[model samples]
Target chain A: MPENSVICLKNIHKSFGDLKVLKGIDLQAHEHDVISIIGSSGSGKSTFLRCINLLETPTEGEIWITGEKLKLARNKKGDLDASDPRQLAAMRARVGFVFQNFNLWPHKTLLENIIEGPTQVLGKSKDEAIAYAEQLLRRVGLEERKDFYPSQISGGQQQRVAITRTLAMDPQLILFDEPTSALDPELVGEVLGVMRDLAGEGRTMLIVTHEMQFAREVSNKVMFLHQGQVEEFGHPDQVFGNPTSERCREFISSVY
Target chain B: MFDLKGFGDQLLAGTMVTIELALASLVVGLCLAILAATARLSDNWFARNIALAYTSVIRGIPELLTVLIIYFGSATAIMAVARLFGYDEYIEISPFVAGVIALGLTFGAYASEVFRGAIIAIPKGQREAGLTIGMSPLKIFWRITLPQVWRLALPGLGNLFLVLLKDTALISVVGLHDLMRKTTEAVSYSKEPFLFYSAAAFIYLALTILTMVFIHFMEKRNSRWGDK
Candidate 1:
């Protein structure tokens, strides 16, 4: 592992009973590396991102987050599980996840949703969490809607709030699982703009997205996943401009 | 024509007792239902089986029979235990206490199924979102999951509560001076069974109507964050 590596996954494999989803994949992300993961719908891009946080619990692999390894054991059901629950939670605390559907708590207001992680899990004082939450909400241009419920907001605004909620944790790495895929075409740019700004500020981000052009413009590196493996990984220019793999070239051309 | 002057006060008192019994049992039953529903949804095999057994046994028995067993059988069960310590004094259980246990247990059995369905109705992503944010499982259930569960379970619970209120009349069979018992006493003395029973029916109808109004307000309150 590199000294500055933020997340490293080695030989990750995942299976759902008879179906093998992720076949032996490895990825090492360094500090300030904004990587865009692009592939077809069933190509395992979301599963790969979920594995980093132990959400899916890779069937066989080594996951080291900032030099600390996640220990896994086979439970009685023969499925892999984090050996130590506290360790898994502690590691998860350092990572943020934004879902494709913008899974905000519908019962809570926008401000309360953002401050929940900091106050409940991180143990920040109410006043402190509120202050930081206000700052994040303002950045997303959602300061006025802080008191509104998630259902009352537009889809694009809700996705931005979801990102802001993840950012409230002040995590070392953030994972975006098709964050804007559920948004309308006109609303996609607003969410992509927030993500692009995050990349500009040197946040470590792993985005599984279907936006080919946005991925090319915002990401320092682009990873093309083909059948649960890293078919092509390099600078956006190299991977998108001139891919070496025939499958990679074909996939890129199809998307473009 | 019925003369209400003789037993009007007694019937009103019985109505109060009936209301108290129903409220107490409802409170206890709601707590039990939440606990049982949580157990049913838990991963522990022992707890799941225990909760399943409780709901199954209570729901299978007739509510009146449960009241009778608790009222009549409790004294024997208590004395048998007391005999173990050589203190064999006969003890009597309060009819109110017995009534609460019987009705609460029955209500809980049906309501727990309602609660379980509500918990399942919530989207899986809500829990996953909480888990990925590093919240403990307990915190996720209380802070994230339970509030939503209550919203989803409100209408079902409301119906169960109304049934629970009416079921309190079953306690009258166990020698408690509830609305039905007082009305029966009045009728026997007055020989105007039709008039006294009609009064009792009116009282029950009033209570049910009041309860429905309260439930309507609750449903409205819960839907505040929902559709515009």
Candidate 2:
């Protein structure tokens, strides 16, 4: 692993029952790198991103994030678990995750969702967390709706709030699992806009998306995932424009 | 056609006793339900099987039989334990405490199912969200999970609560002077089974109506003024 690399996944393999989803995939991301992974529904894009944080633990693999190589042990249930829970927790803290459903904790208000991680996990003072939350809400253009519950907000607004909530942890790496996939066509643009702004700020992000245009425009690197492996990966211009692999071309054409 | 002037105070006191018994039993039952549900959901084989056994045993028996067994069984155990200590005297277990234990055990079994369903209703992502933010498992459960579980479980628990309240009448068989027992005494003296029984039914109905109103208000408060 490179000294400056923010995340490195070595020979990651994941299976569920008889179905092997991710087949010996490896991934690496550095600081300020915005990598977009595009693939079909079952191509394991989301699974790859989830494996980075051990959310869906890779059946067998080595995961290194934020300078720590995590240890994996087969638990009694026959599934992999982190050998050192404390180490995994610290690693998770550095990796912010945005889910597909924009799970903003339905009972809590938008402001509360933003401050939860900062106050509870980061040990920030209430006043300080609230202050930072307000700024993040403003950045996402949801400041006026901060007091509203998740159910009361529009899908677009909720997704933006989800983004800010993940950002509140001040994670060095951010993993986005189909962030806009659940949004309506009209709502997708607003969420993508917030993400585009985050990319402009040079945040290190790993996004699994179906948006071809967003992948081509906002990301510096684009990876075409096919059957749980990176079929093609390089600069966006080469992957999307030049197209060396047949499967990558087929996928690009299918989406376009 | 009922003459309430003579037995009104006694009936009112009986109603109060009934409410107190039900409330205490429900509180105990809630604690047991949380424990049983956690055990059922535990990853360990022993804990899960033990919780399953508890629910199966308690739920399989009739409520009246459970009351009798807990009452008489506890009394015997207490007396035997006392004799072992060189104190040769019968130990009396209060009907109230016995009733609480028996009724609470029955209620707890039903409650475990309610809580399990509520916990399942919550989205899996909520816990994952907490974990990704570095919140400990204990913190995640108390903060992210329990509040949602309470909201989801309230209606079901409230439904069972009504049934459990009515079941308190069964405790009168063990000699607790609840509403049913008081009404039986009043009927025996007056020779008007119809009148006293009607009064008893009215008291239960009135208590149930009041409870439903309070539960409705609580539902609204917990909903934050609107449905999700």
Candidate 3:
């Protein structure tokens, strides 16, 4: 692992019964590197991203973030032990994830949704949380719609708010799981634009996306996963401009 | 010929008791429903099984039968225990208390399902998002889960409450002077069954209409954010 690497996944393996979704995958993400994982649907790109945050625990392997190996173990009686709830919670706090569905809390106003994490999770004062929420809303260009509910906003606007909600957590790493897959084609550009802005601002991001243009343009590194393994992993230009793997070449051609 | 004025007072008194019993039961039922729904979703097998059994047993039995069991059977058991302890010769369970317990238990059984559905309707990602932010489970329930559950469960819960309000009449058999019981008493005394019964039916209709208006206001207030 590189000295500057913020996230390291070593020999990571995950399976759902007999179906091996992620097989012995190793990945290292350095600070401020926007690593985009691109592949066809069911390539385990999303599963791999979810495993990084322990949303879905790996069946076998080690995940290290900021030099600490996250404690993922079962008890003698074969149950998840409750002793490390704090550690698990702390690990989750450092990694924020955005879902494809823009899963904003429907009961809360846009502003409340944005502030909820800061107030409830971080124990920030209500006024401070609100102020930070407003800043994030403005940063994402949704300040005018801060009072609107998720159901009231357009897909593009809702995605932007989802991004702002993630930013409010002040995570060291942000994971995007097909962030634009649920948006309309016309609305896709707006969400991608926000992501592009985040990339420009040097935010460390691991994005799972189908948008070839985004993978090519915004990512510092691109990894192509086919059949539960990283087939090609390198700079965007090296992989996209001149691919070594026949599968990578075929995938790039099919999409482009 | 019936004396209409005297019959009206007795009916009014009965109507008040019925309303009180229904409101009390509804409040208690909603509280229990939330707890049971939470337990039903818990990972612990004991908690989940207990919640399931409570809902199943209450739902399977007829409401009138439940009332009879609690009012008669439980009262006897309680009096026996009291006698053993030498606290009193006979420990009487009031019909009003029995009615509340029976109705509330039944309401809770139905309301648990409604609450569970609403909780499940919320996207799993929202709770994940809450956890990432570091909110304790209790705070998450209040801020993230509760508001959404209330919104989703409103229609189902409102319908249940209406049914509960009508079911208050069943307590009349246990000798609690509810509206239905009052109507019966008034009819027997005045020898005018049709006139008093019609009055009682109208009262129920008026209460139902009033409940609808209140529920409409609540739904509108709660959904105001969605319209923005």
Candidate 4:
């Protein structure tokens, strides 16, 4: 626990009926800490990221965002739920999420999609939100395509817009769940480029990614999960170059 | 030698009534359908069962029977309620009002199923995207789910509307002077069954064509995003 910690999760556990996906995972991200979560498929990388914002509610955990603890209560089905819905919503508003699938609303144009969170949840005026959205769209090199529907754009362009949409909320932390996993091989670079810029800006980000090279290069800290547990977590060089865990070393070799 | 000199105005008036009835019922039915579909998809067991029972009972019986029951039953039911209030006067339910209720209830039941299917056709990711962005569940439905559902449900709803237009003829049995009822009166009075009946058929056909054109325009409007 550091004084500047932005998000802290302790003993996070998630289960689906009889199957446990995440078991006793702990992570504390400070401001400007870019952490990359890397593991093989079914290793709970995405689930661990989703639990931070309560997307997939953890079975048992204490999550604190910017030092504010999230309150949870057991419902009739014995599944945990937010005791105060408004608190959950307010907390979620401050934590941005980028899905693996672009998941852009097809009905709205690129600019409209980017401004949705700012106008709808943040209660910014339409003119102000639109101006901010235009700026974000310009930064992503999508200024000209602001009026295009998501279906009209390339997968890489859509993912960039999705990132811009998250960024528009001015969140304290951003969680990317394999943001480029669904893009084509050639389209991956465009999305990675945008993420690289975000990382360079010193934003706190937790990314679940299969891009080993990009993850190794951009992230200051690398977390390797194996069999629903944190097998190795440390500086990228130590974990990637000389991981103590045998399983993590094997995974690194297989992916590389 | 078709001569509809005396009954032409009566037929015209009846066509207006039919159109008015159809439009009113469409509005009522659409509102009810949205409510029922949402209830049917909700987590509350009571709401689900109530919506299910409404759709099931209304859909299982004939539309004609529904019209008859609503026309006759409502008057009796109102009288009983009035008696309970210590006011005993015979109250009559207008045929137009009864017809609207019966037709709207029937249309709502059928349209609810159409809406439910449309809602399910949307990807789960769309709603999840809204949730992560911090929109309330109601906001998600209004902004994200309802817009997509409306687009998806348009063609299906158009077909139901054509059927609803034709079903308005059933309202004539309850003594409302709709197209069918007017035609019947003209036929018996003039003994020109072929001419007057053919005229009524033409009017109904014209109305259906107009409705189809309107629905096509609506479909085009909804596809402004290019059906992607």
| Highest lDDT against the true fold, candidate | 4
Query: TM-score for chain A of every candidate model?
Result: 0.98, 0.97, 0.95, 0.98
Pairs that clash in candidate 2: none
- Better structure of 1 and 4 per lDDT: 4
All-Cα superposition RMSD per candidate: 1.9, 2.0, 2.8, 1.7
If you assessed candidate 2 against the hidden native complex, which CAPRI class would it receive? medium
lDDT of 1 by residue, A63-141 (tens): 8898888888987766578899888888888999999999899889999999999999999999999999999999999
* Model 4 interface DockQ: 0.71
Number of colliding residue pairs in each model: 0, 0, 3, 0
* Order of candidate numbers by lDDT, starting with the best: 4, 1, 2, 3
Comparing 3 and 4 by TM-score, which wins?
Answer: 4
Instruction: Give all TM-scores, in the order shown.
Output: 0.96, 0.95, 0.92, 0.97
Tens digits of lDDT, candidate 2, B1-228: 334748777788888899999999999999999899989998889999998999999999999999999999999998898888998987888999999999899999999999998888888999999888888898988998888898899999999899989999998998999999999988888898898889999989999999899889888888981355
lDDT, candidate 3, B1-228, per-residue tens: 234676767777787898999999999899999989999999889999999999999999999999999899988998888888887766668899998899999999999999999999887887777776556677778888898888889989999999999999899998998999989988888788889889999899988999999998899989876545
Task: Give a tens-digit lDDT track for model 4, residues B39-84.
Answer: 9999999999999999999999999999999999999999999999
Query: Interface RMSD (Å), each candidate?
Result: 1.1, 1.8, 2.3, 1.4
Name the runs in model 1 displaced over 4 angstroms.
B1-3
Query: What value does the lDDT take at residue B131 in candidate 4?
Result: 82
The best candidate in terms of DockQ: 1
Q: Which pairs of residues collide in model 4? A: none
Give the RMSD in angstroms, all C-alphas superposed, for model 4.
1.7
Off by over 4 Å in 2: B1-3, B225-228
- As for DockQ, the candidate ahead, 3 or 4, is 4
Q: DockQ of every model listed? A: 0.76, 0.61, 0.53, 0.71
By DockQ, the better pick of 1 and 3 is 1
